[model samples]
Target: MVAPLRVGIAGLGTVGAAVVRLIEEQARTLSARSGRGIRVVAVTARSKAKKRTLDLRGIDWVKSPLALANNPRIDCFVELMGGSGEPALSAIEAALKNGKSVVTANKALIAKHGLRLARAAEKHGGALNFEAAVGAAIPVIKTLREGLAGTGVNRVYGILNGTCNYILTRMEQEGLSFAECLKDAQRLGYAEANPSFDVDGHDTAQKLAILASLAFGTKVAQSAVYVEGISSIAPEDLRAADELGYRVKLLGVAVRTPKGIEQRVHPTMVPKSSSIAQVMGVTNAVTIDGEGIPAITLVGPGAGGAATASAVVADIADVARGIRAKPFGRPVDRLRDTKKAPMERHEGGYYIRLMARDLPGTVAKIATRLAKEKISLESVVQRHPEGVDATDAAKKASPVPVILITYATSEDAIHRALEAVQRDKVISGRPQVIRIEKN
Candidate 1:
């Protein structure tokens, strides 16, 4: 009889515990699928005495993560300890050095040191699976790396962060302000006390970097992504989007362009009829545009112990089946270096909201500035006080909102025109700008 694949896991957090429980509950089905039994032979965590409901009766408790990684008895090393550096890095390297397959859900580490780790896995001839790193249980990594290996990917974009999506969804549906929604997200445990990582767009940037590499054969570079968070999005913008047949979403988009791959994360205005716009709340979705195949979108729970662990165990099962594909879809040496795409050259339609001064020539001045930058308006709407006439409102000099939808234009031109208008002092506060995504 073939021996069961022995597993050692580091970090007994929610995901690690779920992984153990899942393996135990699905042992029979796993054996049938993988053609061998799977066992959790050893485990380690920072605090072993921490009371957990787990049944570790026969499992060996290792002293530290590095020791568990180096444990010769276990055939696969699972690293749930998150971080871009230190114990997780060294331990993963040791596991790969020992020719033991490694599985992790650490997106930060993958974005930071993926190439180096991939090199180690390649040299040692062991699999380094991180399907949980991008979208939990979505199976996007396999779709890009293996399923679409024959097709050239033109674009891969998605709503990658759950916290941001939840916040935006509430803002659009309930007309809640960003700050108000953020506080509720914290109360509901969807956001961290220090929620800057998710709200400031860096979390989405890290995930986009990984997806961009997989789709384009470019080396993972978190620095290459242009990030803009949803914090600047306003309730008024969401209302305007509803009226204009669009929905505002925090999207991470990586598309192949004439200049190269353009990876960006920001509050995008997508058509209301589009598939991505329909996804709401904490759910996540990814859309891949390839050469000939119809656009494929995978949607599921982006994060959570059970959702994430499903992907983790799926990767472990691949190890049991002796499937060892290169870590980032291709050999590390074959992956090309990724560089940050210049945002100034970005071309797209824009939704601009300006608080224009209710004075004669104010409209003329704004139009002239846009004309100077060669930006043509597709549509424009001006709003006055509910009960006030235009003449009365203009006499009061109260600033009125003037919303402009522009045709395809470069980012630099929009900035230049807005700067000239700002200096002209015809508008109040900063202008609210959102890029439009067509389908």
Candidate 2:
């Protein structure tokens, strides 16, 4: 019988504990497949006395993750400690420098320093695997890295964040505003106390940066990706979109164009009949378009301890079986430099909502601005005023809100026209604009 692969898991949080459970439950099957057993020999977290559900009596408990990473008994280092820097990065670096293979679930770390870490792993003759970083249990990173190895990938995009998805899904389905749905998500523990990273689309952008590198063979640049949160989306916009046969989703989109890559995370208007449009709540769906083959989409729970741990264990099993691949699917040196396409060059349809003065020429003025920019309006819906006071019409008139769906046009043109319309005296307040994506 082959000897077991010694694993050191740093961080006994939800994901870390799930990894342990996976190893325990799938031990026999994994052994049969890999011809070697996988065992967690050491574990580390901030506190040793913290109550946990897993059985840790027999395992060695280290006070710090750095000690676990450098432990002589462990052959593989599993980093479940989140955060882009500090103890997590330090431990990962130590493990690689010491010639131990490293497996991590840290998307931020991968997005920020993937190239450097890949190079380090290569120089040290150690493997660096992070299948859990991109899509939880969806195996998306592996799919892009190996399944589509022969195909030339043109674009990769998805609904990468669960928190924003949950909020937007609730807003559309329950007729709740962004704030109300976000509060519910937080109460349900789907969102963190500091939910800015997830709600503001930064988390999805980080994952998209990693996916872009794998799909297009480019260096990952998280900062370059354009991001827009769903916080600005109103319930009225959701209802208006639904009336037009569309569903609003927080979509992380990456497209490779002749000029460069266009990566963005925003609330998009998807046709209600589309498969991804139906992926509501905390679930995630990733779609990849290759040069020849049909587009492939994977949809499942994008977060949760068990799902994330499944991905982590899959990487562990691959390591045990001696299966190895490049971190971003190509040699680090061969990966092309990231060239970011400016946001203005992005072309798409748009959903615009504006509070216009209830005057006769207001509609014509708005239409003229859009026509001047070559943007055609597809549909317009005028909302009736409710709960208006008869005496306050002159002091604070509740102007009519006009919602319009526009035909496809460049983002620059749409912005220029919207700016022009907002500045016009006919419009009562700041106009709200959201892009429409045909997925």
Candidate 3:
């Protein structure tokens, strides 16, 4: 049998430790599948004395991650550290420079420095695999990089953040407020103490950037992606969405348009009948709209130690089997610089909910403002307080909830109309606006 494929691991956290345990437990199976024994020869973590499930008795313990990454005895450097900065970047670079293959579950590092890393990996004849960076255990990266390689993918989008998805799902199912759902998520360990990165849509945006590069052959451009979180989504918004036959989901969408490649992460109102809308809780789903083929949607656990380790090990197995491909599905130098489509010019149906003064001309004023922007309203609903007529409600100065579902219109038109409504003092507070996506 061929010599065992030596592996070095950095950051023995949940996923890293899981990978180590999994490799040992499945050693015989992996060896048979890869035509060689997969071995964990070196490992590094913040603390060597930390209690772990794995038997580190015979494994070589390194002081720094960089040392494990640069160890000559290791054939593959597996990085499970969760950051885009520091020793992670330097160590990955060192591994590639030393002609060692790399497998990582770090989405931030891939999103921020993928191009340079890909170039290095290709130049050094080393494999750089990150199937675990996107949708964990979903094979999304493999689907895009292999299964749909020849298919021209025009759009790629999904529920990439599990924390936001869990919050939204709880809010919709339990009719709980955002804060309540967030607290529950934190308690359940689905969210971090500082959850801004996941809840604010940066997490989805980073994943979207990586997917966009593979789907469109464009360079990763995290900054170019427009982002909006679900922090502002209220129970009323959920009710309104249900009333309109839709479900509110925080989605990361990227599509190739005539203007350019458009990438955005935002709370979207998808048709209730759509598959993506059916995904709830911490589960994730990705849909790819390719040319000349029906849309493909892959749904599974988005994150966890075991799921992420599954992807990481898959990448390692491919490396062991001598299955190497371009990091981004094409030569690094051939990837095109992404041209960002202006979000202001994006045309889509919108769900706008406002708290309007209960006056005779209030609805008329909103209609006129929308018309001025050339926006067409598909439906207008004025909700009054229970046991009160419009006249009595107006006499009491009670604010009425007004919902307007607009026909396809540019984002600029919607913003301009909302600004006009705010300036006119027709709406009491900021309006809740959600983009409506078909499928």
Candidate 3, lDDT over the whole model: 0.93
Better lDDT candidate (1, 2): 1
Model 2 — TM-score against the truth?
0.96
- Give residue 385's error in model 3 in angstroms: 2.3
Task: Tell me, by lDDT, which candidate is best.
Answer: 1
Local accuracy of candidate 1 as per-residue lDDT tens digits, 1-439: 8899999999999999999999999999999999999999999999988999999999999999899989999999999989999899999999999999999999999999999999999999889999999989889999999999899999999999999999999999999999999999999999999999999999989999999999999999999999999989999999999999999999999999999999999999999998999999999999999998888989999999999999999999999999999888888888888878899999999999999999999988998999999999998888996888999989989999999999999999999999999999999999999999987
TM-score of 1: 0.99
| Cα TM-score per model | 0.99, 0.96, 0.98
TM-score for model 3? 0.98
Which stretches in model 3 have alpha-carbon errors above 4 Å? Answer: none
Model 3 CA lDDT for position 346? 95
Ranking by TM-score: 1, 3, 2
Write the residue-wise lDDT of candidate 3 on 1-439 in tens digits.
5899999999899999899999998999999999999999999999988998778988999999889877999999999987998889999999999999999999999999999999999989899999999999999998999999889998999999899999998898899999999998999999999999999999999999999999999999899899989899999899989999999999999988778899999999999999999999999999999999988999999999999999999999999999888989999888999866778989899999999998889999999999999999999999997888878898977889999999999999999999999999978999989999997
> lDDT of each prediction vs. the true structure?
0.94, 0.88, 0.93
* C-alpha positional error of residue 60 in candidate 3 after TM-score superposition, expressed in Å: 0.7
lDDT of 2 by residue, 248-344 (tens): 8888998987778888888888889877888888999998989988889999888899999999999998888877688888889999888667889
Kindly report which residue stretches of model 1 are placed more than 4 angstroms away from their true locations once superposed: none
Q: The CA-based lDDT of model 2 is what?
A: 0.88
All candidates in order of lDDT, best leading: 1, 3, 2
